[model samples]
Target: MSAPLLLILIAALAFLATHVLYEWLAKRLLIVSGAEYLVLGVLLGPQVTGLFPPSAVAAFEPILVLGIGWMGISAGTSLRLPRLVRIPSVTYRLSLVESLTTFALVAAGATSALAYGFQASYAAVMLPALTLGAIAVASTPAGLDVAFGLSARAGARRAAPVLRQIEVAHGMDAFVSIFAFGILIAAAHTQVPLMMRALTTTEWVVVTLGIGVVGGALFHLFLGSERSPDRLFISLGGAVILTSGAASYLQLSPTLAAFVMGIVLANSLRQPAPVDDVLRSGERPLYYVLLMLAGAAWAPGSNVVWWLVIMHYVVLRTIAKLWGTGIVTWINRAQAEVGLDWGRALMGQGRLTFALALDYSRRGLPYGDLIFTCAAVSVLFTEFFAARFVRSAVDPLLVPLEQLSMTLSATTEAVMESVTETMAQRFPALRKVDPDAKEHEHKGKR
Candidate 1:
């Protein structure tokens, strides 16, 4: 898209962010994923309005990489291994059980189903399997105030143990899924140089890990001693760009490399909040772009009926999750610390799922579009039913949802500041009763 088109897109997004109907649909109805934009993107895509063609969608790939890298960094920073070890062993066990089972069942089912039924190449069959497997291991921690909404600290006190276990499990799941997805990107992806083509899959995987480790180390070295939030924001952006550029060139997962960089910085930084806050502040714009691209990629043809494959994909995931939860429940049947149908609590797939989805589209696989389409459908389906399903297992709990991106917050602040300064210059006396001074005076008066 040209600059004008980009501006129009931005204007439309700004409108959607504040629109009352969108508010009702997002906050009041759906479980709180940015999936509404994705569906909207699909509607305006080539399959529907043809406004966003494949070429137009491709134009946004660089931005897509940046967005995925941001998500990976967010995931990595969320974990502090020092604190992670403190969680009860039971949490790890349940998380592992559920994640592993879900991955095994869903991946195997998807691969087998596609191979037996669809007419795609081996790469196509394996691509979706790996993507789904990585995604399967993920669970969103959004709805809890400690997460996005579980704010009645005192009221939810009884659920504290529950919350901790779930959160730890969630972090672990994200870690594994991202790591595995990165590996899949390295191993199965086919964009190697002719000279490096002789290298084995194991070598590629090792290179992927190496990129992440080195990127992480370099990030810290470059960010040394910078404590200002503004500086941190700039450094973070630069790191994301560098790591993403390298990954894109190597045809590896940029998010995975950024994830490792985040982990390294996370462990090293005494004060990570400045950087984390800055990164998180920009999440909305990234998510909106990614969600739309993921949506716009779905122009399905008659080949094996893409919708049918998507349905099958969702069903397998649902069964795998439920079955995985059943196993966990049975294992913990004797323990009170464990909740029932823990998988239900984990039903929120959130951004990571979409992250992997969007990343898969970059691989140039034959059925890559189909994989992303399935993911968008899954995300939407999960977002719609997330809270409903959670209510079934835990009445006080809502499903995980990423809070809507505050895209306009910074712009709004800047505008307000500019207006205030302009007014202050116009009326010099107005500066005498500065808000800070007035607050101080009021406090003194009180």
Candidate 2:
């Protein structure tokens, strides 16, 4: 059997087992965004194993690239610009401030740490730090769902007045993170195509954006605002493949380009987006695939310098997250009641970090291993703290379950009573002609 093909069969089987194991692991945590898969991958990977070697794993890059590209597209589609325009301006300001500040603080600290403490060339120190900065900026958009159990339209949101602000920040923070990473690519390492060797950084950016627009147009033309569910999925897959393939050819970031395509579709498409439905339905397998790739690629750096950098990364990220978000929460405090420990609301890291790491760490860049390790470690730690941080956030807001149940019951009763009274007042004949209507409805429930 061919080496890469054999490796794939092994990973495919391991991935099935990982999915089952991950479901079991997820039960222990309040929120698990596939970090465990990375851990399992590490255990099964060449670093620890009887598993596929680095050469074989490297051969699998094409598949991982498309997966991460889809992630970028997925994030972009989440933004519906017309609707976001109506959210309070304060939210926009806060998301901007928080995202930028966190990026700046973490990037600066990480660079200083690596340049001074770790022994690496200029590129090695700068690149990973900057990647971490981008990873640090996006607070997971799902954080609210994890925190308030917002999945079912729970009442916790009514108690936490800052949810609108929290949500806007979460949704928009990825823009700042991804754009910063894209600029990093253009400025630091983007390759010169033979025909485009003289283009400046700004021109390079234009080229990448053009690629995204083209990809989106391809998707737009193919779907034409309508397609069956199955075809819609195929069309999106094809568009992402083409966009990512072009970016890969140019040594530009596929994630960034795919993101641009997603933005194009989200804003310009006039009908309900089947793109989202397809992505949602297919997201789990994507996560697992990336998880296996990330795990196999993960190699723990075995020196004090690397460990110190990891430690510095976690500390700096936490301080940056708290300090940046705290400052904004303070500013927003005067504007709204903001009833929870608002600083921690947006600290959870999600798939965007994984997506970026997958795009970067697989490229044989300087210290790519450490960057992937940091991304995994960062994700693992933040998810833990984010769930823990909910205690400080929701503890004060908690109501007794029985009491809440009674309150819901009373509210339902009061609403029904008001409706009946309004109907009787509007039509005196409703009571006279159908005197048993209310009684019959009540009795039917039994």
Candidate 3:
């Protein structure tokens, strides 16, 4: 085998191993620090080890982009229309609120970092551009998955129900973030042709929606239930691979395109079993790939970048989230269900930071190294804080089940008595027939 082939094989295995370790560790740690794995990958990457050199890593750039695109699409597929339509008004309102809050926080944080110490004018322009683009758009469904799984394990069904809600919320947020990014990139490009505006504007939206509809229809017609579980799963993966490649070749947004495919497949208003089966098979692998790429993409920088990162990650971003979340709540009246302050506090940054930082570096933006440093750290902190907040929510389903098993025996008995009385009152003849007898029967069944 050629040296290049050997190196590629070694790097691929190393990347996979790092991701597996991170997944294992993320489950065990109280802090849930998965972002560290990505940092580790960078430290061990060719940039440092002279194993897989800069040129070799550069070769993976297209893969990284396609992987990210698939990640977004897969994330979107999870947003079944039923959940989305559950609180259409609420979803729309909260999505706008979450997106704006994230954007404002990232922008302010980026600007403040520049004001204080980011001396390089080139770095300043790129850092805010990259960070703002990232912070505004990120939503970590993986973190939310951890929250839901834990809640299920702890017997908090009520809390677990919130999982679907959060998924829908994150999906909408991702769409908005990506859409906003498309606009931002368009505006930033000086030589953008007038004709390309259509590509960036409503045309993009129409194409995305159209792709989704077609994909969904095809899934509904042929692949819905005819194939075996394994084949059905592989078919979906094949579709994503094709769509991603096509999008990449066309210089179109693969993330948007792939997501539309998922949305289309899942939203066909048909049986959800096929869609569910496909997700069951392919979702985890895709997630692992996306996350590993994310970690591999992190290119650490010098002291200047580290200092700026600290400033933006903690101070500026935090202030922006608090302010933006609060204002959004006030305007949308979402405080009735989700506390204004709490929700604002929980709108922490993550994946989007990595995506945008990679974009900055790939595009050869000046001082892009500093942007990656700041983004990686901010994602680390945000994951920690956001996971904690989500874990703390009162899941009504989870509560009742746990109480029935352990903490609420007495209350359960009292509730049983009250229910008996109400049933007796509502059904006089049945009460006469045997209220006490029925109570004994119920207790015996339990």
Cα lDDT computed for each candidate against the true fold? 0.70, 0.72, 0.57
Candidate 3: residue 200 lDDT (0-100): 47
List runs of model 3 lying over 4 Å from the truth.
1-33, 108-131, 150-168, 186-222, 273-277, 280-298, 303-306, 326-336, 344-353, 365-368, 384-386, 393-412, 415-446
TM-score list, all predictions = 0.79, 0.82, 0.71
If the candidates were sorted by their lDDT against the true structure, best first, what order would they fall in? 2, 1, 3
Model 2 lDDT tens row, 291-313: 76678767676877777778877
Worst 10 residues of 1 by lDDT: 396-405
Predicted structure 2: lDDT = 0.72
lDDT (10s digit) by residue, model 1, range 262-317: 88878888877677777766665677767776667676556666766776677877
> Residue by residue across 320-410, what tens digits does model 3's lDDT show?
4466656765777755555455343245555544564555455555556666666667676677656555655434433465577775778
Alpha-carbon lDDT of model 1: 0.70
Q: What are the RMSDs of all candidates, in order?
A: 13.3, 5.4, 6.7
In candidate 1, residue 260 scores what lDDT?
A: 81
Which candidate wins on lDDT? 2
Residue 220 CA displacement from its true place in model 1, Å: 2.0
lDDT of 2 at 9: 71
In angstroms, the error of model 1 at 38 is 0.8
Q: How many residue pairs clash in each candidate?
A: 4, 0, 11
Q: Give the runs in model 1 whose Cα sits over 4 Å from its true position.
A: 1-4, 11-30, 119-124, 145-159, 194-197, 302-305, 396-446
Candidate 3 matches the true fold with a TM-score of 0.71
